[model samples]
Target: MSIVGTEAYPQDICSGGGEMKNLWASQRNNKGAASPLLHSRGGCKGKTQDCSLALSPPLGSVSLKCLPLLEARIVAWIGGPPASGKSTLALRAAQYGFLSADCEPPSSGPDWLSGFGAVGMTNRVLALANASSWLLGATTSGMVVGSCYGEWMPSSPAHIMRVLLLPEQGVYQQRHQQRGSTGWSTDGWRHAYRQYRNSLLVWQRDNGTSIIRIQDRPNETSCPDKTLFDACEGIMAHLDKTPHELCFYCRRTRPPQSAFWLRCPPECLGREGGERGGAGHASHEGASFPGASSPRADSDHSSKVATPAEMEEIKQLLLATQGGRLDRSATHNWRNPSVPGRYGYHSIQIGNVNLVGQRNPNERLNILRSFLNFTGKVVVDLGCNVGGMLHHLAEVKHAYGFEFDPRCVKAATRIAEIFHLPEHFYQANLNTFDPNSTFRGLEHAPDIVFVFNIGSWVGQWQQLYQAIANTGVPMIVLETNNDKEGAPQLRTFRDMGRKVQFISQAKDDVTGNFRRKTYLVTPA
Candidate 1:
């Protein structure tokens, strides 16, 4: 049976275009272009509403009666690029009391003739169609994870909500390139998928799909495995708990309307000339729940600053660097979740991916410029995340960063290589490592040291300072979470006969007040 949704639980449907008529109804003439989106909907044309869904599987495909009512509970349909750890995330998510499955569309061989055009196509289209049916039926109960390919959307839109994983373009390319090592050709489906990838993202915006920016699985490292499985579990738990609502046709989450016998209310269904997109569709009659107000946890922000094309490019660049895994999302803010991505970065412009608030590179660079010229300086940055400050100091002859997270270091290195900058990033336990030892044989000796907003570690500052002091580097730059914390760090440098010059830094993310100050500690 075709998956269908009533306006009462519109948000339950797969993420896509504006509120529409029932899926099985006559298509609307909204002048919108037809997308190759596997999941889709249509405008209602007063079509007859059927209570029992018909799982019309392809030949030799899984049947509708096969949904494991006993085993399967609730499934979330996931959509994103390959190797995005959809299965891994789904499995981890299942730990939160859900049965999950990651589904892959069947692959097919090349149709030699189709490669002549700009957009190459696959000959194995029908197999994918059958797989799509299997995925749809699979979603009838337990959690399901799948990708966004042609003619596929969540088959159980009323129960299966869609989640789109958006990775930085660098991360996307890197992951695929990595798969190349195993001798499996990366050129086939991925190439075509990448071409239309942004379109799917665009469809996400147009229809209000949920977007999650994840980091990539990194290569084997010489250092100890420090990845915090606990933190990730928390993020996943938080995500699963937070509610999201698509503003296009939001309905309160409760008993799904699809379970209701009628599409429209019993009173409205028989009304003259009824349509799903009309006033009767957004009905608020007896739909409210006690203590529950809105479908969205909070109203997420939407930025209008960047043009669509620029936004698309930024999105591609972002996923290319950190797709399929978890990165420090905008502001380290994972408090509230939303349907359309709740981005923390400045929406109007491109900057480094920030874990906290808008730690503007220009602001940091300007603070540096006040104390010393970065031109020809050999810079060593401690606690750098993707090297935002190093990127801002473009005039520096050379830059080296020591970061705790291996993923962050790789991201920083990727940024440097992409921009053709002279920078080196090494994964280091910054808190315990001697700063001089951290850069022992690096391309350039440290002429200046930067310690940006890492006040959370109280005890390590003294050790970090002692290491830097031995390096003959007389200048140290620092930013703090607050002036109260910055005072002590600045005092320690003063006790060492270093003059502290200060500039304003990022605002307190929680309060949106009290901007942190940047300090330049120079040997006096």
Candidate 2:
């Protein structure tokens, strides 16, 4: 039997050598139109035009012998975990034949396609959205997108093809810590991984999609070999093929090259004038997925500098500080005089709110201008940390800051008083604040609420929906690191009957460096 997409004749069996050579030749023959999946592999070992050799394609129906790994829009829903190989597997499929679409949710906007270097909570939604969108109204022979499953956006059930990739908890953590990543220190990845796994189980029970274990494959390689054609072959296995019957193609091991660094020790940098590779690539050595990591300690003194080891320490410190409560009163210094340069330098007012310390004068001015255009007087701030945004809102709108952190509430109150803004700053989680308590005044309710990426808390969705349902105010939500967790959080919000109008979600840039993201989500 011959496959529709293949350029060659079908053989009794598909060998790695023939398939790889064919895919390699295909690279140079159709350079521009070549799949992004093939891009990484095509560049490998300088095989510019290796995939063109139409020697032979894999044979045997997916049902006849191989596992029926139907290429039906499989969304991996990859989360931040160790050794999950979400990108590795997804890229392989995309390159081979699986139409892969990478979605960075938190960074959703016109420029959402960029900023997908690391696997985080936000990437899950982005991946889901990209896969789902591709699956929407289109026929997918085989599609695999990897991100966290919880971040999935509800689309037509017919379009979804679910596949779960799980690794051993210990191995996951070991691999994560090895690469200086912060979120998945094995234990954390395991926790989140279990959550994702459980969610997948529930999802599978309701939504039927193929699930295959990497360990079960005939070849030892669970993921596709990262060569141009090898990646494409992995995709072919998923495409319109039966999951259980798809033959596990043998994957040859490539040299352990650094696409980005996981966790290389400082010693890895000290090797003299470069014995094997260039140290210039060291900066990007352990960058999360796609983001580059700067290796030079003095490369950018503007941002807080931490050595690779120091960064690991800092991450450990941050994680250690997670559940600990810091007494605000313990420190006599109420204000951090060293205000970050990232906060645009500008002074703007919205109603009684005056946002001081805006580092960027123009961005602040533009925001104030937009505030005047929409808001008459009332303004609501979601995730109003330290009431900084509220101070700005008070300049034009009757501003109120809603913060869940007690420390932030204290700081916001102080900042509001310091700025002498008439805005009301309250300590409350927007997801769960009581309507009666929050709505004490006869004062005009806010027409626009400002929220910054506070929608990702799965445990708090119900409360958030209730709050929105009760408030009935059109909100402008700004999310930090929106590129990381944008789509998953927003999808949850949308599912709750809250009409969300996307404003913009992109990196919260500071000068030339990337900071976080600002999402302007308004209730439609």
Candidate 3:
């Protein structure tokens, strides 16, 4: 038995200098059933050629008879326009044990994949392919697949992460040109790109889809392939988390029951509601603001403003220290009784400036509060970007932050001075950081040490862990890059003769994309 479907382009247009033809065929023999295959036929120059590609597992890899025992489920759906690298991402995800299937919409009708029609068609296609049983025993992570469009509403009750791949317009067009596809006109492709761009925001808000923007740049740090791989790894890590472990708004791990509700507590709800103008806005009104402020009262510095000369000097200092980028390390705003104007990345207002950052340091502080007491404790923060967390820990005896970036150190120092905070910032690269020598002159050891989202960057984990252990610090609070990194980090801690326990998987509000696992390390 064979199942075949053909996608044909208009005669006036061609792909690869010829009419584009896509054939999806699956064959089954008496011995077993072969996985589906996708074939493309087009002409280059004057000659017509056929290109056969196996888009799924090999024919005999998993027999049809074993379908009943398999437990495959769709973990993620990758959606984008043509040439946005959707197929490449799908294939890459398959390497990590995710079954991949290409479910393109019919070529003739635009409305075929709209609303319920799209969801129904996607379900039918996956059902026909036996997607649930494709590679059950092979890997537990399940599958990641989708169509060329950027909208999907799956009927499955299982959580399906929606990822939209949007490349730069120039890159999108260039990809089509490089493939020599003429079946679709430039105007048509441009229109599709515009539509995806315009509607993606609304779609994302409605469906909670994560959008990954792909840019074509020369920098190796921002390579599109690496970005996609990181995204895939993030999805895999997300699958390991239970529904109650992550927050509904931020997707970070939930704090313990003693602290608040497992999902989004009132704090997160207030923030989310304030951003989207949802009912959560009412929650924000009743929520107590962070810091030394009384309930529902204006901040002490609300009516204060920096002198004109001080404001000018502050601007110059910010530019010089932050290299003209106001957002870097400006996690919290310099609000209250200072110069007025919205500046920086975080949304909180400090003085007069509004730092519109994605992650709230206050929220992180609340999570940490649930774990340990900070009253009158000396704290050491490793890789403290701009001293956001240190600033919020006003109850601590004193806060010492070691940062790698000299510019960040300067910015953090200035902010501390401005607020009269009992915090100090120093420059030290954690890769070669030594706690023994660094803390030698201190009168007392830090009560608690915070290492957040910097373990992966520290090349000498053994040396660093050993030095930290030697410090005789009572507690070490660490936030790893992801769930996968937690085990290896814990092993390193064990090797260094320290007892490390996972606290929870928390969202690093800084980037807001990756969910990091938090651990508490104590001397053995």
Candidate 4:
């Protein structure tokens, strides 16, 4: 049977575009009986809307059939670099009652959903085919399409409802690279995918597609696709329970989860899980809930941003340093054995791998290490926003942190105490650290120090540069900006030539998106 989606024809329509074809029709002879999923539309161009699903052997016969029926409407595509836990997150959606499908290899995926049904297609390619051809659209039942190529825009005009899933490039690459030995061509496939994604963005803009940009890292249970399904369930439940005039498409008027609408499946009125108590917003309140926070999770205020090339380089450097998996035994991020942490640090999967650099401790360490080397003396985190990076660094030796935000200081100090590290936090801004501020409280002025260079504006950049310059300590800087404009303030450092050397490096992950610079400056 053909794997990728094939174009279909409608009653011999003389339309252009190479005559609507019957590509995968031959495979119908070999397939098993058709799935009895009822559809609002009988068929999309007479194409068999059979649920061609595969279940891993581990899941018994009863579950194989039951799982597909349990999924909700609306399939979401979760895309990022390869091996960025796209499949893992997709399965999590399946576990939570969305008929989930993924493209991971047989070894890692369920046996039932392993083959043709789980054919791997980039977001761009998926967009290239007609949208209604998707299984969810086929049955007129909402489904979650978890994928890593959230960047595709289809030539076929389909509904523009989608959610983007982004994991840290650093952690993603580190995980792949640490996998003993991935094929050398792996990087090439990833580059091609990124290009496809960029094209998708362009297409999205051209077509005026509605984009729901999800910026938060997927917490342990945050299934983007599944959450959407649950939201739909809640809305439907509320509408059925109330006598309100709620539209079938949207249940704004319905009292969500009222008594009347709790029918249990088969019938259009039945609720899949019986009582909708744990299926609504409250059940998903913690970190797993989608759109819990606005998408401005990455605070980008750097004065001098690295070029895309430079950013990719910085990503590579960070990935090289990311060694062992998270010590699951220890309270840290990065638990995958494929992507390990270093000797002096611990891996903590605080958020999704994509958001690791911004939120995950391992990524923070990767960014921080660009400047500080804790070989001789311990390093200090100047602004430990969350103790993610700080806690990992403390594993080495005498790592102290200072947070200007009082709330951050309390949290940082509390976490340090819990982690059994020395309570060393200064709840004051760096401006307050004048000579009179009693360096006595300082836990040995670190031989190395790290600043949150990503959010440093022009003024803060100058202050940090001058401070590092005066101290005569070699430092690393972090920054981010769209490729549209380069940062002017950092241009001066490059103008100095040999005084400040630039080291081209990769962002931790293999995807070429995120890269930064490490300036090796000799004291003037």
Q: What is the C-alpha lDDT of each candidate?
A: 0.40, 0.37, 0.46, 0.35
lDDT of 3 by residue, 1-524 (tens): 00011112123211221211233211222221222322211101121112222233222212221121112233455666665666655553443345665555434434322432234454342231223222221234445665546533221112345456655556666665554334467786777667567534424333332233333333222222343444543443343342211222122222342122332335333222112210000011112212221111111221223456655554554444332323435432112112233222222223343243334454455446546767557787877766767755545655677776565566666655554454566666576666876665444457898887666656666577767877788999988867676667778778878888766554423344456777888877
Segments in model 1 whose C-alpha atoms lie over 4 Å from true places: 1-357, 505-513
TM-score of each: 0.35, 0.31, 0.38, 0.32
Error of 4 at 508 (Å): 7.1
Model 2 lDDT per residue over 1-524, tens place: 11122333233233444555545545555653365544553222122223322222323332222122232223333322333555544544444455554433333333233332124443333233333433432433445555434323222121133344444445544445544324335577666567556644443333323223232222322213322222233334443353211211110011144211112233323322112111110111111211111121111011122245543432232222223234454321122223342121222222222222323222322333322343234666656555555443312435556655555555445433333344455555454455444544415556666654455432464465456556666554545434556566566566666665443223223233244454444545
| Two-way TM-score contest, 1 vs 4, winner | 1
Error of 3 at 309 (Å): 6.6
Backbone collision tally, model 1: 30
- Candidate number achieving the greatest lDDT relative to the actual structure: 3
Error of 3 at 404 (Å): 1.4
* Residue 200 C-alpha lDDT in model 1: 53
Identify the runs in model 2 with alpha carbons over 4 angstroms from their true place.
1-375, 394-397, 429-432, 435-437, 440-442, 456-458, 478-480, 496-499, 507-524
* Comparison by lDDT, 3 against 4, better one: 3
lDDT value, residue 160 of candidate 3:
40
| TM-score, structure 4 vs. true | 0.32
Please give the RMSD to the true structure for each candidate, in Å. 23.7, 21.6, 20.2, 21.9
